[model samples]
Target: MTSREQPSRKRPRSEDASLKNSLSDSERETHEDLIFIRPMRPLSVEPDRDDKFWYKDGNVVLVAGNVAFRVYRGLLASQSTVLDDLCSADPAWHVDGCPVVHMSDRAEEVRSLLSVLINGKTYITKREVSFEDLAIWIRLAHKYRIADLLENSLRRPSLQSPHHSITAVNLARLTETSSILPLALYDCCQLPVETLLNGHTYPGGRVEKLSADDVQRCIQALSVLGVQRTLAIVKSMDLSACGYSCRFECADHVSAIKTELLEDLKSPGCRHPLCSWARFMGQYNRDMTSNVKNSAHPMCPRCIKTVIQSHGQVLLECWKNLPELLGIEVEGWATAQDA
Candidate 1:
């Protein structure tokens, strides 16, 4: 049967009773005849002897979907309270002389969970778990109340990378990992709106989807970031500290820089003969400190010092309000100075 037409095993009894009550006499007869005439086959079960996860001496067999994993019962029970309760509640559900625990999770998800639990590992090593594996692991960990697994999954380096920021946001929301949300949201702010809405595929062949809410947050944050970037650029263009010889030239240079920045904002791409404002905003968006001394613009030494100090102050203000800009509450974020 097609997935859409497949019967739901977990459908509520109230819905089933309501449907039965609504059926006409002829419809009821036809439904009963259909049920009586259809042949039901015994469930086809088999052991998955994949070398990656299967253990010959394991005590319990975990069946997730069509795949079976032979793993230690004690390890799983000790690590997961839900598993412990299940084993304690039913001591007699056995298949082929070994206890069989049927799980609703997919085979790969179960394998990822077991990789962390039974293998004497605190976290799945970066080499072992891909972005997709980490996402699934966090979900299963939260479902099964595996605290260590959930924590480790959140702490994985993959979640902190720029490429996986959207995935991190989705996983953070799913697992309620509040600490990672602010950083993930900040990273989302750096991405383009189209990339945020349509999702980006990582180099490892994992496609990450951002929710509509996440996309909206990015949109709002990007708008705020643009305003902040413009304000910072305009504030740094103050030429009062310029020397008498270069004051007028510096003022005109700053005006040209502002115009270039505004044009770049409209196009949202790097251009040849990159403007000072564009470079500064690029560093600013990445939350990096501005290096006025190395800026491409020609400014008097005194004016450069003034620009540096003003940009520093503006960056501090932006950092202070970053959480508010992203519509998230962040705790213990380092200031620009601290960074």
Candidate 2:
């Protein structure tokens, strides 16, 4: 047989007294310089009893993080295919008379999912799902394959702010729900390059970011949206320009609206193309009203109607084609104009 070198034995966690005794003081100091890295330990399976979700007659114990929820296996299996498969597997451990199944999820996430599964719509009196609540509910619902609950969450989304737009996009992608992507992606396009890179932090200090592909798509949207915004402004002016006397009499007033609109679109800073334009829209509205109030060069009511109506019409068309502009395809997407 060819001579083979034996593998060296690893030092025990406790220092070896015989090995220490065998070394001289200088040798021991040199040996002490060597560091022994401990192997990673497995995640803890043992969990503390949950105060609210634990039941006396529960047959299976779901351990999430450090909390355990003893809920019915039958009920969970009935609602979730993933849970059904998990329940059928033979558990390697048991707690009380119940089998202990380790769940790699936060305790709160598990609790939210269970709350809806058990209580149905009565969990909240009005069933108004907040953005945070929707986020928490949808993630676990999709992970567990609870189709009904996922559908329920999608239908009642209350995430009306741009702050959670990235989270909304992620959730939509995760659940394959395309209806939310158009608005969410448009909001993402509005974010500054810096904000897109740094990402938005939620209430719990968790940072939400777009995927690399989404970042690329958002970047692509910036220039296209800038061009579209300019075109829409131009088209609105054309369609809304009044016919005879009002057009000439309030020409300066119409000119002011166009000037402010164009200037608003040219705002600086690290904004993504046309992003800052929408931010100052209220300023335009204020200026229009204040000019009339000052009696300086008030636009005729008809002249004002031209700017407003044609602008609204052009924007309605833009809204319809928003998904296409961002290179996202959202099936069954429509603004009220379509309705």
Candidate 3:
């Protein structure tokens, strides 16, 4: 007998098939929504309309971060090879059909650099530039390969205050601006190592800034110079030549001066006797040229004159060895020629 063929059974559809179909419908709806949605407007990076450098008729816009500068392309090209090459390579950077160039630089820095290039004058005059501003200007000038700006940056007044001196030293070292090193290092030697390391806060909460390595160098250099300075002061004293002809009185006076100087060495700070002597000598030299009487020392006039001359000689020796003391080379390093 022939067995009845078993009825064929159909295989059940997988739950995965239904899930996939639902996902496809959802994806289709999402795509349709995306197609209907309007694109967000591009953010405007342009500076204020009232900005001094902002030109309504400018042919090119330079965007540095969130700020945009409207300036002449020819001016930038004339000043910087790097900028010229960048703009030349990219002909399609535009905003609202106006050619735009994007730069990875701070707006303030770009503004300063552009101001100088366009106006033929720096935003801050060379005599009034702060350490921070000078540092930024020099760095940007170097980065943009603007040799004129770099040279102009170097011509700015050397650090005038001890706090700025710390900043100058670090900036000079960081930027490899060898021309500013000698004076900066000399100023640093006037300040205490603690002040150099921890920094001194100004009246407005602005703190003097220096690198750890620079602080260490200052400490080492000052330590060496302290010995040299003490020797200079002692050698400069002439006990026999004092107005007081009595040997005992002159001896006592010399001993007192030595004692005070030694005490200052024990707790050297910005106001240390050595710094005071340097300042006094500086003033004396200036007064001598002007024939003015501004000597503040209690020592006799003859003694004071001799001491200033001796200090001058000592400072000359220090200047000659300054680069070596700081563990750097003398070649290409700047020194105060008048020093």
Candidate 4:
């Protein structure tokens, strides 16, 4: 049994890499004894060997979809005890003198998993991993009991990505990746209802959808979040009395801000009112560059002193109640700061 040494987890690594969408050189390579084929090109039931993963000295043939990877059994056995059992149990099924293990996963998924196992390009180490791709990796990792791979794949996804939509909440539910749920659901609430129902578009315009149950959850959660948004607005709406009462601009701006906040409640999405509000006139909306990010109501020193103080507390409290709002109970789920 040939083996490849696993990489050190403590090693300092940087520069995230992405899953390659297309092969660099020729998608296929020919050899006297072996021929390598890129997956998803479609092949016969017998399947074709992978262009990148085939090794001349491999002891096992792992078939996934219509593609195969001829790789060392010991290398896999070293990573996952579950894989070790599978590779050894089916010795009676052999291909070209190497034992065959047929997998139900898609060829592309197997390719990604093998790449991560062999190349050390994991979700955390990768520069950017889309939620869809990460979901796939996680499913495979769980199926195979690949502890390291599952641990890395389970790291919090980039909720800030526009493509991070309701699909994430659904995936989190399906994969039992609960830590991702609270924020993922919160992020979904920020989208317009049409967008939430239809889902966000990736670079290729691939739109992920939500399950009916999740759709219902989000709708219910949005209504609850809307109340939170209202409370935040009401908390700050009384800023006119803070020594700036003599200034008519303060009253005028407060009125304008109140109207905008009220409109947010009527809007089709979660306004994220607290996070978006600043100590300045960010609610009043004057100028972008000059107004400063998360600006306060103008010339109101009291607002400057206490706006974030109140909003930050509200944001934390909102996050604390998130799992309950979504109505999903996760084992050992704990609330984090402003998730």
Candidate 5:
């Protein structure tokens, strides 16, 4: 066979010299850029009598540059000052006046200013955010890319108190808006059902008038949004005080939720530790010889089929009476109104 053209002496290894040289140059440039840029962002500068920047809309500092913003500690304590600043129609030397300027080149400076504004405040001061003020500040921050400041401000602990009624309008305004804080998710999950059902209505119906379809939608929405913990919290709510109001308005949801829960229980690895004791105390027995959660003998499929073909009331009655017949100790299930 004609010898395949003797593989030309394998080209000697290139040693990645070109790649190594290019990478070294790139890394050097990046390091130089960071070193040069970081210091341009000053943490603090004395405000001149004719300061170029001014506080507008709470903590935001508006300067004459590309959508630049900063936070100021002293201005946050006064609402009137914030309002007056935002109302300034012709704020010279302010970002609002020169909104078209491109400040993307000075990102480091903006970060430094924001760090100064937010970090300067004490934890107690930050926690005192009202809904309206927070709404305004978050809007400005998002517009200017104040990611760190937004995180710090909204991460402050909040309690489930009636302090939200005053800010209802603001909360409603920001719904589904990207201008909202990431922590707003926490607030949404924490909001009282009473507050939600109230739905911008005051001095009237508290529990939302949920129809069958509305209940299905809310359940699906909550599931899709991955708020399982919140759903569990909702599941645990005690609605006994409202009596018929709760029964009529919330029954379908409650029943559907329980049905889903029972299916979940039937799945593998769904054993709820806290409810295990309660579950064990309610197991059905065939020969009436089982003690509790565990049954001594399994029943025929015909018995199961007959039970499945019954109404909710009949099923509940059978459940309640199962423990009695089989000598299991089960606390009778309470009604939706009692939940």
Candidate 6:
């Protein structure tokens, strides 16, 4: 019952192994050329290896610290314009490095290019960047439509630098109409005068927050509130009588901030006509009247209206201007008019 042993068949080899041996000598040489080529890994703290990481998914390549050649090598060889642009030094002498290379998270240009590479778009940025190069980056980011970057820039705590005082002053001047945050803007009245002067180029620019002697400073600073409407806020707070009458110079300077100082007239029930007179003088300009074309005069009718509408003290205080209305001699008028 012993049958002839069946001839054993050769087992199939793995495709990888068979394919390896299938090449002729020269073909085998070419097979070695088929070595797996991965993309160069993004530079990091990790050690480098010959086996590169391929980026077939097409990501925004973030190449940092002298890796331009590697990044360029991976893509199809061209005239090398993109690589050259990245490698060249910044044309603006203001920037310290090639903003395109060694992409620091701090570099605005690199941040921008990185955003475009990864997110397929740009951003607007102008944060508290102190460095000239970073500032350029912020400007470019702003130009390129990177909104998040711009917001991030704005949200950054303002830098404290030797030139920050000057920068803050200039920023305030520039933002007088732009609605950007005011430089030394909030409670600048409380900052030290020496600090403000040493930091900024503002010759006569006084920081109000630090010095208490600056009533005019407060008025001037408050006048620049274009970004924030302060009328209602000012009206809500109780204002003390400014004792300019005691100081001859202070009384004379009253005309300088007549418009802003007029808010004092919004008192609850103080009807001294002199106060109303001063208030009327504050806003009663012929130019304003001409612009609005109200038939009733701003001073005569409005002043009386304010008197009638207010509580008893405010009414009496408003009517106190009555003697002045008829050109009668009021003793204080002699001094104030003389002033």
lDDT of each: 0.62, 0.67, 0.60, 0.64, 0.34, 0.33
Models ranked on lDDT:
2, 4, 1, 3, 5, 6
Runs of candidate 2 exceeding 4 Å displacement: 1-46, 122-125, 238-240, 247-249, 269-297, 331-337
Q: RMSD of candidate 4 to the true fold?
A: 11.4
Under the 3 Å rule for N, CA and C atoms, how many clashes does model 3 have? Answer: 0
lDDT per residue for candidate 2 within 1-339, as digits (tens), equals 111134223454354456656878754553342222111343355678988899999999887778989999877766765565555545657788887776766787888777877887555336666777778778877766567777778877484677788988899898888877877888887776887777898767779999988888888878778777777667655523345564344665546666666888777522332232332333333336654332544545555565666666767777888888778777766554489
lDDT, candidate 4, 1-339, per-residue tens = 113265323211121112122333322111110112123322345778899999999999888867889998877887775566556542435678898876666787788788777876433575676566677777767766677777777873543464465667766765677777777777777777887788767555557777788778878887677788888777766654455434335555565667776886775554674474563444334344465522454435445444445566667677677788888775555533534
Which regions of candidate 4 fall more than 4 Å away from where they truly are? 1-44, 91-96, 121-123, 156-163, 191-212, 240-248, 270-274, 279-305, 330-339
Model 5: how large is the Cα RMSD against the reference?
22.2
lDDT digits (tens) for residues 105-129 of candidate 1? 6777788777767654444763656
Please name the candidate that would achieve the greatest TM-score relative to the true structure: 2
lDDT of 5: 0.34
Global CA lDDT computed for model 6? 0.33
Error of 4 at 101 (Å): 2.0
Deviation in Å, model 2, residue 187 alpha carbon: 0.8
Candidate 3 residue spans exceeding 4 A from truth:
1-50, 89-93, 121-128, 170-175, 189-215, 241-254, 268-298, 332-339
The sequence of per-residue lDDT tens digits that candidate 5 reaches over residues 38-66 is: 22332244223113333454343433223
List clash counts for every candidate, in order: 0, 0, 0, 11, 3, 30
Model 5 is weakest, by summed lDDT over 10 consecutive residues, at 272-281
Arranged by TM-score with the best first, the candidates are 2, 4, 3, 1, 5, 6
The best candidate by lDDT is 2
How many steric clashes does model 6 contain? 30
Model 5 ranges with Cα > 4 A deviation: 1-119, 123-136, 162-198, 201-339
Q: What is the C-alpha lDDT profile of model 3 across 1-339, one tens digit per residue?
A: 111134223223243245335556644443232222222344444444327667877767776657777777766666665565445433334665667666666677777676667656445463366666676777777666667777777777645666678777766765677766766766776876677779878655658677777777777776677677677667666555434454223344445666666677666452222333645543433225453433322344445565666666666666677788877665744344343
Q: Is candidate 3 or candidate 6 better by TM-score?
A: 3
TM-score of every candidate relative to the true structure: 0.63, 0.73, 0.66, 0.68, 0.24, 0.24
Give residue 175's lDDT in candidate 5 (0 to 100): 36
10 residues in a row with least lDDT, candidate 4: 28-37
